[model samples]
Target: MNSPDSQWSFTAPLSAVPEAVNACLDQYFADSSKEFGSIGSEFGQAISYLKDFILLGGKRVRPMFAWAGIRAGLEGGGGSLSVPFPDATPNPKALLSAISALEFIQACALVHDDIIDKSDTRRGNPTTHRKFEEEHRQKGWLGSPEHYGISQAILTGDLALAWADDMLLDSGLGHKALHKLRAPWRAMRTEVIAGQILDVTLENTGSESVDDSLKVIEYKTASYTVARPLHIGAAMVGADPQVVDMLRRIGHDIGLVFQLRDDQLGVFGDPVVTGKPSGDDLRTGKRTALINLALHKGTESQVKKLRDALGVVHEEPEINDLRELIIATGAEETVEDYIRIHSQRAIDTLTAAGLSDAITSELVALTTKLNDRKF
Candidate 1:
């Protein structure tokens, strides 16, 4: 059932979601730091790094999509042509806090992903594991700094997941809504891990087929990043099953394009802009669709170049040669085309989801921003 106060006193402008969600995260961090302060100075310091890793900066894509889905679900619940800010919801802050949990899940994903990928930096800051490793070195701690770093980062990721569940429960969404959210919430966490496992397995299997790459993104990125967040909101508001399904469908395609854009940036983007070295994906031997297509479409020599350099090349010149091969093989062009087409298809589905034009336009804008991102 919808909340007693059907309309919030104020509606959040679309521009306010990131800021609002950030505020929630800031508050949570403050409370958490205090609650966990008694553990130990070393533990306290570790928490600080985890806090900074999360709050330093982010695009807040997951929370924004969660809020967007809430908006859609609110409309669906009311059968209204337009949504009032959080109509049929609990307290504005409460509901916002509930959705803001997505950020914590995101935090968990990023920290663990860095560990798995052996990434040095994220958004121009040291990755969590790297930060911990450096701390161990600086303090002359009594263990392998690399091993210490990974262990701490793993715990940090686990803490973030714990905090996510707590945040949702404490957000005052009420038991009924929380109960409804259980499936989506659980599914999101598991799917992301499953996807990560697939990603790791792919690196070893050396399968660069486009289908294989797509399969990895299907669970690892699309579902966790977009679809499940949307599903969470829809379920919370008890939207029609059809609307929920439509959202899931749109989220999948949109999520694909989102990651596709990320793959492009991983190779072609400037280090300063993208916050990672160019060709990082190639260095890591990620079996991205871009790599798969290049392997499939390239001439024998061009294919051999990618296969040889992938997971091995480090020098800029070698990376540049690989970049050229990707472009020369037309794989980059194909990925660009996929991003455009899938983004449009997702938008088209959103347009038909019986939402008000304003809501639809905002979601479309979000999709455009995601695809058009340079970083």
Candidate 2:
């Protein structure tokens, strides 16, 4: 097992990972576009929209973390760098293609999430369904615009998911590497789906506590966003079992930290910055940990203010009121403390895992950037 390396710190450049991932995604999208165009121009037009949606904006968090996982696996695999340092790692382009699948997974999750949330905008633009709805209206289509939008968006998300599988299988990593990746990939898909179901169930039934909220993210965000991606990377190279186990724990902690930050962003982040309307969570009646905390601790009137607005208020002023109530109850600060505690736990665990300075530094750096989401 690796031991803590004090020299490690996050110094990796951000540009390289996203750029590589984007280039690979472009190829995959082009390949897909060609296939769709061969079928029909209507199909071609829709795919073009999907392509723009994907390439528009994103942090590419999952693929970067997956890369970190790959590094971790490489260090422990056997070669001076890993078990299959030179061989199992495969060509650099192939590795990027494989991990880039995570971005598609993210796209599918978001497209579906927006549908479920009935969100009007994403990344400050109309959501998939809304975009399709506008196109339907523009072209004077024959059916209900709303239904057409929903159906098309669903298909778009499905295409993204199908292509995610294709990208991984076609990545040229060879049978052994692909076989290793399958387990985590399967698990991540299930966990995210289960998490989404749990989130919807809890919201409709009323999630009232921090534990309930945590349970939601544990499956919904943690595994899909962090833990399993790490597993996929480690598994990609057949990383040592002990190293894999350590990363799972670290990923879980980090995933929670990431989701907690998301909770804040959901309620407080600027639409310009977050790319979605502030208080979308509130409008959707989604009870995140921060909201749950406020519900438990806020004054009667403040609590009432939140309750009255839950799932009803769509415009301003009221949303602002709800935001203030959360702050006034001190839940925002309390959640920040929770974030500090969880983030520290993740870092400490990673430090104690004692992986190579290279892997340790990159993971720490990624975690830091994830945690420090001021916007």
Candidate 3:
């Protein structure tokens, strides 16, 4: 085991990748704006909203994962960064394009996610629908301002997603690499839509068992967040079966940890850190870890309270009370412990795969940073 500063340390050095990716995002949106028309201000505004989402600071974990997979495949046998490419040729430009594609795809997903969840903000900024809604009201838009905002934002997100696919296809990856990437990329998109439907269904109908909700979380949050990205990236570089299998297992462990951390943050992170109101999850009555815990472990009376809180999304003292109750019931601690364990497990899995220290170090660092995220 390598004694290191922390899991997040390696990530600090990787920040430049995200900045470059953001520059690409800016260009992408600018092109979209110009395509719509010089004077299509509404379209321009929507494109700007997409740019804001792309520029919003995040861990950039998915893009980094994609790059790492490409690197691993290019190096062959999945080892340290010290390992040179087979031909001793580094394709930095191609790698950067692929990474940007991953980030843009994530942006598209998040935009759609906010609309589905009716979230008001993201990364400390107004969500697309929320921004459009406010703009509509301020400008005294024609009939049904709220509906118009939602409709336009949804369409904008769809366009972003379509563009993401185009970026990936046009990323200049070789034919073999592109073919490898095709299946998982296509599957991920299809599954995400299916997952979204399941999510909406659960929110409306409610789950009788925690396991059911967990299934939804796995699909809606996990596969896209970790599994598919890993597979796609690995495929891009023509990873062999052994390496692909290892990446899948690692991706599952890391992805679940990522979602678990998000659940915890939804309940406990600072408003400034999370870019949402305190107890926002509770207000939205999101079926998160906290609610799942209450449903599973609370007394009957507490269960009733949790049910009542579902989908409220309003300002109320009871929302805060529910947050406290969730913590008091030990759900928060349970989730925290779960995150710590799986995060370490991910690192251990990577280490045992006999990867070089440099690669293992970076992978461990990525897992740690995500697990420890404040936002």
Highest-scoring model, TM-score: 1
lDDT of candidate 2 over 1-375, digit per residue (tens): 111122222233333677767777887887777766678877776677677778887888888778777777766533122322345643556667788888888888899988998888877778899988998999998989999999989998998888889888888677777777788999999899899998888878876978999998899988888899888877877788888888888888899989999999989988777867677788876789989999999989888888888889988888888888899999999988977887888888887876777677767877887888855
**Model 3 / residue 359 / CA error / Å:** 1.6
lDDT of 1 by residue, 1-375 (tens): 222133332245455677777777888888888998888898787778878977788988887777777778776434221222243444667668888888888888999999988889888889999988998899999979999999999999998889899999998776667777799999999999888898888777867779978988899889998999888877776767888889899999999999999999988988878878877887887878888899999999988888988989898998998999899999999999999999999999898778867668888998998999999
**Model 2 pairs whose backbones collide:** 3-354, 4-354, 77-82, 77-83, 78-82, 78-83, 79-82, 123-275
Better of 1 and 2 by lDDT: 1
Model 2 whole-model lDDT (C-alpha atoms): 0.80
Per-candidate clashes come to 0, 8, 1
User: Candidate 2: where are CA atoms >4 Å away?
Assistant: 1-15, 76-89
In model 3, the runs with Cα more than 4 Å from the true position are: 1-15, 30-42, 75-90, 309-317
Give the distance in Å from residue 271's predicted Cα in candidate 3 to where it truly belongs: 1.0
TM-score per prediction, in order, is 0.92, 0.91, 0.87
Q: Please state the error at residue 297 of candidate 2 in Å.
A: 1.9
TM-score of 1: 0.92
